[model samples]
Target chain A: MTGDTHYDLEILAELAEGLLDDATARRVREHLAVCDPCGESLADLAAVREMLAAVPVPAMPLGVAMRIDRALADEPNPFASVPVGANGLSKLSLVPALDASAEVDSEELATVTPIRRGRRVWVATLGMAAAAAGVFGASVLASSLMSAPGGTLAEPPATSVSTPERSPQRTLAYTVRASGHNYTSRELSGPLVGYFGPEPGTGSNNDEQLDACVQDKANELDRPPIAVDRAQYNGSEATVMAFWEDQSLDKVRVVVVDDNCRELRQDGLATWN
Target chain B: MTPPPEQPATPEHSAVAGARASVTDADLLARHIGGDPQAFSEIVKRHRDRMWAVALRTLGDPDEAADAVQDAFMSAYRKADSFRGDAAVTTWLHRIVVNACLDRMRRKSVRPVADDELIEAAERDTQLPDQTAEREVSMEVTAALKLLPSDQRAALVLVDMMGYSVEDAASVLGVPAGTVKSRCARGRAKLAPILSHLRNRTDLTRVSSAKGAELRDG
Candidate 1:
């Protein structure tokens, strides 16, 4: 027999195990019908396979199955949690149910709620610190004014104006509301409006490309998001709103900017629930 | 409250169909994405046994096997969305189980037994109950399997015995389907001669039993 006929044994093996695709299996079956040697080999493989099946599965030790069930129980849903890489991510193999769906129940949601609340608490705490510093400086201005001989303390200029009410690093609850239009639209909440701050770039801010990333973080954190109304922002700029669970007045910041990086309008509301 | 009686997994009243009815892997996954935690249970029930078997064979220790199976399933759950559904569900599960088993093996400090030693050990371990009716058959199969390489043994076990398709077996072994076929072929060739001898012994047993019965009657 030619070497090729001998090599066909591999295909026959797969065929014996029911692994061959229909086309491949058909070809192998045709060959087996005519080739007595291959047929006998196939028959032997089949018999051994049957015998192996007849041998009973070894009994698993006690509590082993229950322990497996428990491990499976603890496995978190990948969709609800984080995406692990293919190389060594333990999450990928264990939690099949978690991957299929995204609908979280209220109690399951409770586990995540603290994380959300913690984020809000941290953000609000930073905002409060900023406000407290402002208040202390304002008090000093009042003392200086009372000491003036003309008895006129110029109204302490509101520091809230012109100064963007956002710190550079305060983690904002940034959400992107995008729709297909002539111009891409985006919404900003928390601290950013005019630009995402200079990262040594020469040109204008590219919020259009950045919207996808912002939305990704939103999905990762499982924060409740307001619908990005597609109908309202057909073209031009889309209004961005960041929701802070802490009802601090200076918490929300909205920046409407044009394509050329000019700020069209900026509004910062520190209190948002 | 009285605990539920320990019933066989496949019960007459609560059939595999009913047990399967609550959720399937795909359904649980879909529900899990929507955030239902209970859906995870279905995935566990569906794959735990097969996962355990793969781990037990690959790792060879009960504790390690249990850990590997758990880790494999948990890892699969964590990456459920990444599963593109290109492979069959079984293949995907096997891939996870095999990876976990291999990982467990790698983490161990001790070296695995050499093939000759393993064969000897296995033969010694499976020593037949001398008087049992099934002894001869068990002895022959065990002896034959002991001679095959561990990889070939696993291939035969999964493909020939357990009835996984070649594609599924290959996916489990992380090898080519062609390799699986070759292994299966070699495995059978190695087993055939041994089985022929076993058949001869069986015939001898039948004849001897017949003679002894006649003597007793006479």
Candidate 2:
């Protein structure tokens, strides 16, 4: 089988790049010593690699830098004012529920209500500790806005992009079936550790498209999601799921996405190191 | 007294915020975790440029790179508690930024763009005509780079363009040094044919310029 076949570009490149084992390199070089085309190809590849190295990395534009600065400034911190470590991670508490509230109705999934976590959820200044878990939600007003007619929202209204001829449940395609039970705002909690978005056909979740979308998100996250459920996050319809940021750590990242697979929640829970 | 004017910044406060430059990266991270409002901001100011460079080179799209870099800083801010101090802070940032790019790439599905289209795109840029030579070569390189797979592009960018040693890049990428070398090798091989025109163009320009210089001297 070891006839007169020329080595592929990658193999020849490996030899030139010093990646091949000594024995293989010797073999390739022996062939190259006799073959002019292979030799020329190797030289050209080396020159190309050199050209790639010649271009310098450009600096981040000033506008982009300022944008990132503003982003970091918005991180949630609970211990900003009190002396550092005075109130440790466990000691950090939510300020009294201000004017906001998170109300969930059990039966008929009725009663669209206002929801609020705590003022600390809105603050900067952190106490670095194990981020046990965050049942992350989208905009605080998502649920209220979904339930109320003609309500103005910071985000555009959630209008399903699917036409009527398409599957009526196409709006549910990106989210795995929720076992036929809709989740209220309060049902989501605890650590995020699971294979992916509610086992595909647990109760009524056999929607193949939903399964496919969830799997796509899993690949993007590099980890299977814990739950991809049809739920009212705050008051908005969303697919809430958890992804492992770094499994070695004790926390997981939770995100909320709408029907179009766009992440609805721009804000995420923060933990200090 | 107008609610006592909300407590003023103590001299103690000025020292911490003012000493941002002198503070070590790890100390700044620690300060951020401790609720120092300005510590994380200072960290971003210091490392964002290098990280932005890495992201832009790996992704080849400024808009995507900007989003990836922003995502990296935000993730790092949230995951500040996860840093174990086993690596340099820059290494940590690189890993976060690289992973963010990978995520975006996976979501967007990278595809190759033809060289002519890219060159046309470059000509449309509003840069001064005097800058055309450098800008043209840059566009050529960028277009050729877009032909590579994301993993190969990332390894090539870190090792060849940004000057990270293969071993160091492997640490940031959480892969073996051997893997980085092979990826770079394969990426270079793939790019060779596509980029060969550049080598020919350089040779031609050099020959023409030398002839012109000789004429001037005569």
Candidate 3:
């Protein structure tokens, strides 16, 4: 205490900050009203607080920020990514998600990480198609295009079986490959003709034996199948169903599922520009 | 305004990132859970500077501050789904970063490797534009803060420097509001005489306290 007659800095500081009890703060205020040094000490403490508040915040170093970015990018998938890439889901493991798999070799299964599960192939393709079509471009580009099942993937280009996983830097590689089918029209009958064989027996939902599979496909797409035809996709007896995604009817998603509702990977269709 | 975009960030990725710039922090965390790979990164990009400031102010060193911030983000990334969302995301984040800083301070205090941080801090990292004044202020601030204990330093940084309310500071520091208030008060009393010379305020008399003499000689 200055002069052995006034309160020390701590009491005065607490009084200044209103941290003291009302009775003690009143006594300190009365003492400070009669004493000059104690008042000066109190004012100086306030200045210190002001100085702290005035201190400018330093900018985060760019190098440090970039380092954080690298560390984040290298982080492996932490948890589940629900819509697609969910573990143990129905994904085409061996067959590439693309229509042109002529170069597919046996080793393609070991090296390529099927993170996409081939289920969102049509979804991501539709998203990118929306970008190309420029109809619902902005919202579709950010939302559906972004979450469009593996719209961006690092696995091997399933479109070309011989390519092998070229670039391993997830998100930036093969995000939007050229669509193999336009999917603009609903006429998959010609390509799916082989599924019905030489004499197509009135193939309009006539496959009463595969009624459950067709309904499962319908339930998955949230709509009734527009056209269901029998096919041997990837050497398995499969049902190829074309789904009209929305009321706009500008987009069509084709799903190839076997006797079970599991989606099968079928890659081999001509280009549709 | 954009801080002059960095390199290796592709135009398409930049555009996509820009499109998602308006996403709320909670939504970004949710999207990360929903399997959007870029969602978490956007969260990082949005909050790095704020967390960096809190970490740097608490640790008073750049390298350690960087590590603490990294640790906090990595922890947050792994624990995104577990966030209960009761508090503001910034509050939860500052808690992580401040906890990281306090942990580092505790470990550093216990370990033999001391004073090396001060020597290395002299080397200076990067020179940000218009950072001269801020650097000087932080240097003085750091020196003054080193006089106090780490708890007091954390409380003062949040309450005074960051303008956090006492309750918010207490929340970030995981302490009672009374504890935060008392720390700030005791810290200010000790800092008043020492920082008067550093800040050179006009209205204050320069009384030489024991703490002031110690700081002056050191």
Compared with the true structure, what per-residue lDDT tens digits does model 1 show for residues A135-232? 22222222222222122432321232222334433232221322111112222332221111111001111355444433443344333222121111
Candidate 3, B1-218: lDDT as tens digits: 01112211121222234466566778988888776666777777666766877888788778778889989999998898778778767688888999999999998883332455553563343222244554455456666777788888899988888777888888778789989988998999888788766544332234434443232232
What is the CAPRI rating of model 2's predicted complex?
Answer: incorrect
* Model 1 alpha-carbon miss at residue B61, Å: 4.7
The ten-residue window of minimal lDDT in model 2 chain B covers B1-10
Per-residue CA lDDT of candidate 1, range B101-205, in tens? 666555664455564654443333232334443455654575566567667777876776556777778877879988887788778767855664443433232
What clash pairs does model 3 have? Answer: A99-A268
Off by over 4 Å in 1: A1-47, A58-62, A74-78, A81-273, B1-22, B57-64, B102-147, B193-196, B200-218
Q: After superposition, how far is residue A24 of candidate 1 from its true place, in Å?
A: 19
Would you list the rank order by lDDT, best first? 2, 3, 1
Question: What tens-digit string does per-residue lDDT give for candidate 2 at B1-218?
Answer: 01012221111121123445457789989998897766776677666657877887888766667789988998888888898888888789899999999998899786555667566544422121234555666677887888889899999888777777887889889999889999998998899788767766553223323322222222
C-alpha local distance difference test of each model: 0.45, 0.55, 0.54
Fraction of native Cα-Cα interface contacts (under 8 Å, chains A and B) also present in model 2: 0.45
Residue runs of model 2 more than 4 Å from their true location after superposition: A1-5, A78-273, B1-21, B111-131, B203-218
